[model samples]
Target: MDEIKILFLSHTVDYSKAPYDTGNQFIQALRNNNAAYLSYVQLYNKYGHYGAHHYLKKYVRDNGINCLIYGSSPSEFYFDINYLEKLRKEVFLVMMTGDTEYYYEIRDQYYAQAMDLVTVNDFISTFKLRQIGINSIPYYAYYDSTKYSKNGNLAKDIDVSFIGTLHGGAGRWHNIMHLSANGINIETFGSDSPNGRITFEKKIEIINRSKINLDFSGVSGKTRLTRKHQIYKRMKQIKGKVFEYTMCGSFALCEYAPGLEYFFEVGKEIDIFHDKEELLEKIKYYLAHEEEREKIAQKGYERALKDYAVERAVPKLISIIDGLRKTKTYKPSEIYLDEEFIRNYTTYRTLLIIRFITQLKFKFAFEELKIILKYRKLDLYQIVIFFKEEILDMFPRIKSVLKSIFRRQ
Candidate 1:
């Protein structure tokens, strides 16, 4: 097949502008292999939606881009009816989301409606999307082996270490405290930790130097989002830390989560823990049996390079894109807000209400809001914004409620 031109839209959170971003990694792999004509536009921490849509359209036309790879949800991008209508006819939109726990509820509904295909990092997330009639693919995180390989010179002196968020109520601190009390010494790193803001290079170093890299999904259970949904099912998705530590030649003792079985043999290539007691047991067993830990780490590294590296994964992604193009259909730029679509996807509908309220011209906004409100389904934030915008024109009851709120304030 001829080279497929791709425009990657990355939702970057880190302000450091690291070169090892997931989008950059995919781009480099494609470029390195002479696989495709690839370009990227980062959405977050940089451009507003209008600016994003402008550049996205320009790049699609100028480059004759065949595919657009969204690193997260399309909601993160500044996509409107005009851009959606124009680009859907030209480029196949593909979404690659790792954090299904957060995105699936709020952002993914937009992805479900907008994208040609959606690829998630876990099987559970993939299955859920497919059940909703989405063309979803199950994919795992890929790291560059050349950048993340183990250094023999770095001493594996640290027995246990974790290098991500310690807060946001995902129960990392609680688990860490439990393990610590049970006699496992884990060196913590990240912005929330005392070690603080390590570079990507530093992350690789730490991973290589640790005997057992303790990995957490960094999802807090106490959050309102989780409480409102099936929290356990969300946590069933695997984290990128599994691939990262494994590629760095460190034995990963990850918390029990689904999706690991698809990549690795749980007991042979990696280990998992359920609670403090189980974690402590595994840590003690692994530490005492140095040979076992070394074997698992070695197996993980081999698996990573052979099967999970970006070099290996990108070709497959390109192949999928190529296949998707062969079967591509010319879809009109219609904003999908069908009743069944709205009823099935609360987050998508809620986002539509907000986007309609906040993004459209004023003349269009009121009419759109009234239609959405008549639908009788909205999130708390959307409702607040609705009242604040006076979309209801303060019906007698709503006016009294607003008056009471103001009196309290």
Candidate 2:
């Protein structure tokens, strides 16, 4: 039988209008090649929060799930657990140890249950897993490199560019200080900049043009439960943005991490530094050696396309699932019928309430709905009309909706 691949559970805003949305980009890359029997379902939670954990299990049985992955892209902020109850398949948690120790405990518990654990580094709790006899692997977080190109001439209009929060904490302040003290021509950008956020392509262009783009991560430890201002500090696991910079053919001078040496040969693939001094020295050397710098950028670009894309990463997950099938220890996932009923209740409730109120309002009496529907396409009016017809058949129970929406409620 062919293997099934599901890129599971995303929490991101839509990006149809935005030039770049990382979650949307990930889904795009994973679906790009049409590799495996690939499909996707966005995560759901009740109360407009993360859905029940058991719901995932049931969805699997109904849909015939063969694999599940917790997509571990970086977050500018942390959110609460919402959809744990619905998850059923043996999971693969792709965690990168950063400033937050949020999932450290649950990660160990899940690993103990024969589920595979994938982290970017050999973290502290990772070692503990092996001490107690658990199997896990290091899966490098990947980026879609093809989108970025190494066109002629680097655009260095902006010197010493930086992205990310400016005032999330002290680390950001430190990054600003490091670049300024070095006296490299640099421009500060991101949340710390006058207005936060930049376009994905604009970000890439900025890095390509700048001599060195600073990549620094920030974390606040007080997770509504702590005394320490900075909780967990593992500066090594630099993620998607690093690959992004490289793929654009821009040289990155980033913090040192263990496995990074494998992807990048310290002085070659890109540059790294222990502290402010070491980083400054390398930047000066590379600025003088443009040829060497370009060579390194090309090398990093090659490596990124080869190893850090969806084509390179998805197969690893598939193989692990096949190995698990040989062991055959899991109970097939199952979801109760009420879950579907609840979904129906949830989906239509908000849509109907808004639609009905609009129809019944004086605007229908006062003017054309189109004047108020400027932003909303309301392309699904046919579907809404059909549904409201059903409610209309049921009588006064839904009469309020019609009065409001149709100006009759």
Number of the predicted model whose TM-score against the real structure is largest: 1
C-alpha lDDT of residue 53 in model 1 = 60
Top candidate, metric lDDT: 1
Candidate 2, which ten residues in sequence have the lowest lDDT sum?
Answer: 76-85
lDDT string for model 2 (1-409, tens) is: 4455454544444566754654555556555634222222232222111232345555555665555555542321112222332233343322233222333442323323333443433344456555554445554434555555555575556546677767653365675677677787667667647646777676667777876766653343333222232345433444455677777777777766545576667677787776667767777887788788778877877777676664566566456655754454445322222332222223333343343444563332222233224323332433365466655766776776657787543
TM-score of each: 0.73, 0.63
Q: Where does candidate 1 stray beyond 4 Å?
A: 1-3, 11-19, 31-62, 73-77, 81-86, 221-236, 329-409
Collision count for each candidate, in order: 4, 31
